[model samples]
Target: MIRPFAALLALAALFSAPVLAAPAADAAATPSWSIAIHGGAGTLQRKNMTAEEEKAYRAALAAALDAGAKVLAEGGEALDAVEAAIVLLEDDPRFNAGRGAVFTWEGTNELDASIMDGRTRAAGAVAGVTTVRNPIRLARSVMDDGRHVFLSGAGAERFASQRGLEPAGPEWFATERRRRQLETMKAERVGALDVEFKFGTVGAVARDQAGHLAAGTSTGGMTGKRWGRIGDAPVIGAGTWADDRSCAVSATGWGEFFIRAGVAQAICDRVRLAGEGVQQAADTVIGEVAAMGGDGGVIVVSAEGETVYSFNTAGMYRGRADSTGTREVAIFAGD
Candidate 1:
């Protein structure tokens, strides 16, 4: 029989004994994951939008973020989450992409899209495609099935059709608001400006539980664009690029500078080679490549579940949601 003092000592010892912590769970089992998205980049302002219009933009952004977060929570690949989020924006007319894309000089709508798988360095893109409803989906399909890296024009449309992608009439993409915007730009003689409106495209980058990275970009092409102009959207390194060892980047801005600098891939390369943080690498690229003579912004997601969004413009339509339920959305730089 233990004395009262002895019993008290045993209790103290038991309480003080190293509470054996459960074995640390696998990182994959408790993956550190995140999702980020952008509507586009440019001079977004409150004066340029009405209350209802702002609400629409917010709602659209929220919806996209929700979709992406859901995918990440389900152990989906980053590519799937990014694409799922972007498709919502692509299908919405509130932005200049997919179903609501801007018109070309010939009064026709042209679309561009790209997707990159960080794990494989595999990418696909479509340019000057007029009939496909969802160009990004078609791009992914190409990456998965076709041997080609890029497809353009009527040929791309044919390939999309062969792949069972839905085709729509040209009228299906037109919007009175967009037409007026084009007319206004033309009137101001600034239609040729280097994508200052920020109405470029939708992009997403994600890191998943499986330690994978992916990126995607979808655009209606440049506003009031001419001569079969293809922006960086379809140029893998320029507009969209990803690599698991580095980071995934999606760019929105002056297509010419983006293409010349390989904005997306350049950011990734900086991280892989220089060991820069996601924000540092992204800022360096944007300032060097995009802000040199061009104008625009980008969203980046690193392998460690870090996100960086930087732009020179007044604002960029952007949002982010992480595994910890941190959800935030913005339209302007200040937002």
Candidate 2:
């Protein structure tokens, strides 16, 4: 047997030695930081989109990724990064959150958004707000205010004003495309869609260098929603959830099913408690939504920095970027 002094010296050296380099592939598999975002999920088909339309969409997604990545690279909080990405998407009229929001049955715009911080498990949401420039920012403000988890209608707007949040006129949200969609719904004389629902929610999820996770989602609700309708986007556990113990999730699709299924929290429960991978948890949850006669998608980022996207629709406008120089943006199923 070795002498005790020699054994002690050996142990010291072993402990002080430099760490071995991980394999390149393994290192790449796990980035120092990661972010993922989605514009919406629906019956998106290549044939229905023009080449220019596809190009514009890809560019918009890429821009959102850039905004979020810049923050994470500078060691920003995941909550801020998520808000940054979503703000860009909200301003882009191609998506259905802020500027391009769909119209209510009464021919007006109503916006909804929610944000969660995994480190503290704090969240805030606003629904049926008409004039916030970016609902995601208002959501962040609400979360920071330390009171109330959800706010709605004129009350939410008053809270926004009190917080000095940016305000926009209703006309700022009235896009030509949204008007056309509202007209289509009215001409068809259908109160709501049975099969032609385009789930137009925009969202982001991210993990920062500090290991904090955050998620945020913003939406204009459905094309012809009525009676001050609110979708999953503004419901914390349904459309958005973040917990340091699990992952951060932002969901888009049929809000009713998502609210009933509690999609975001469901994904987190499977991952946090059951030791399931992020993608596996997301897939299982999305599959259940489909079985329930609803279809949509979610983007999730785990505490361990794993990014996942799961959807049951034909396509979801999605993108991801990480510290490892990996960049991806796609709208099709396989892409």
Candidate 3:
């Protein structure tokens, strides 16, 4: 009943109408900046520690958290936040780094530290450096220098000097408590030192407002360590790793086992390729390490700000802070 011209007009109108393509899939929202830290993990027992000792430890952890949290709150890079937090711990005589570093078999301090940037995958590390005031700061210098990922022994000290990092004398690193502990270990004449002495390495992981992640670890190595021993704390994939695609990790535990397990990288791989959550990945890895006769713990932060503190030991000194003003510090295993 319709004329041919009318039919042609109807078709033209139908074709002329704009068609909306299906809306593009919504992108995932970036996470708010967050930070997490660990003093160390070992056979810590509440009954074994005095009230005064516990208070001192808790206060130290809080101060470290504040240092990193301040950086995150002010929109600073995650790398700087981690560095700031570690510097404070390194300066404090309470922890087994810097001023309170444990003595080696030769009765001297050998420091180790590493730092990583998730955005660029850049990393820096130093091992067996005796005189650097803050090994974490020197590690950052090595990272920013862009020439090498690791430097060790006298070479690291030379690099520190070249970078103008201040050097501290041997006396600056020897604390009376650490000296007494070393003496006790020597008296025991045991093949392995007590696990209690092993828990003192300090580490931090952070996510910035820009969605970047960074991780760092610093330690005085192990008490009575011999032959220039180096632990996972100075090893990139073992003690520290950060990647924008997955997560940032800082580990403190048995360095030998952590190195074998590639703890940091393993955690990220689980998150990146297996679609596992941060906590699951960390827990699984820690369990595996425990099964292998290693004890320790790790702090992890995903790109989206999810965090996990996983350890097989009795306790780990840890804390967390986020953009929402949430902050917590804990030391006991149940806590």
Q: Relative to the true structure, how large is the alpha-carbon lDDT of every model?
A: 0.81, 0.86, 0.85
The candidate with the higher TM-score, 1 or 3, is: 3
**Candidates by TM-score, descending order:** 2, 3, 1
Ranked by lDDT, top first? 2, 3, 1
List runs of model 3 lying over 4 Å from the truth: 1-31, 195-197
Q: Per-residue lDDT tens digits of candidate 2, residues 118-176?
A: 99999999999998999999999999997898899899999999999999998889998
Residue pairs whose backbone atoms clash in candidate 3: none
lDDT of 3 by residue, 155-222 (tens): 99999998899999999999888887778777765422352434679999999999999999999978
On lDDT, the candidate that comes out on top is 2
Q: Pick the candidate with the highest TM-score.
A: 2
Residues 178-295 of candidate 1 have per-residue lDDT tens digits of 7776776666655533223565789999999888999999998777888999989889999999999999999887788789889999999999999998788877887775334666
Q: Which stretches of candidate 2 lie over 4 Å from their true place?
A: 1-28, 190-197
RMSD of each candidate relative to the true structure: 17.5, 15.4, 19.3
Output the TM-score of candidate 2: 0.90
- Report, for all candidates in order, the number of backbone clashes: 3, 0, 0
Sliding window of 10 residues with minimal summed lDDT for model 1: 15-24
Using alpha carbons, what is the TM-score of model 3? 0.90
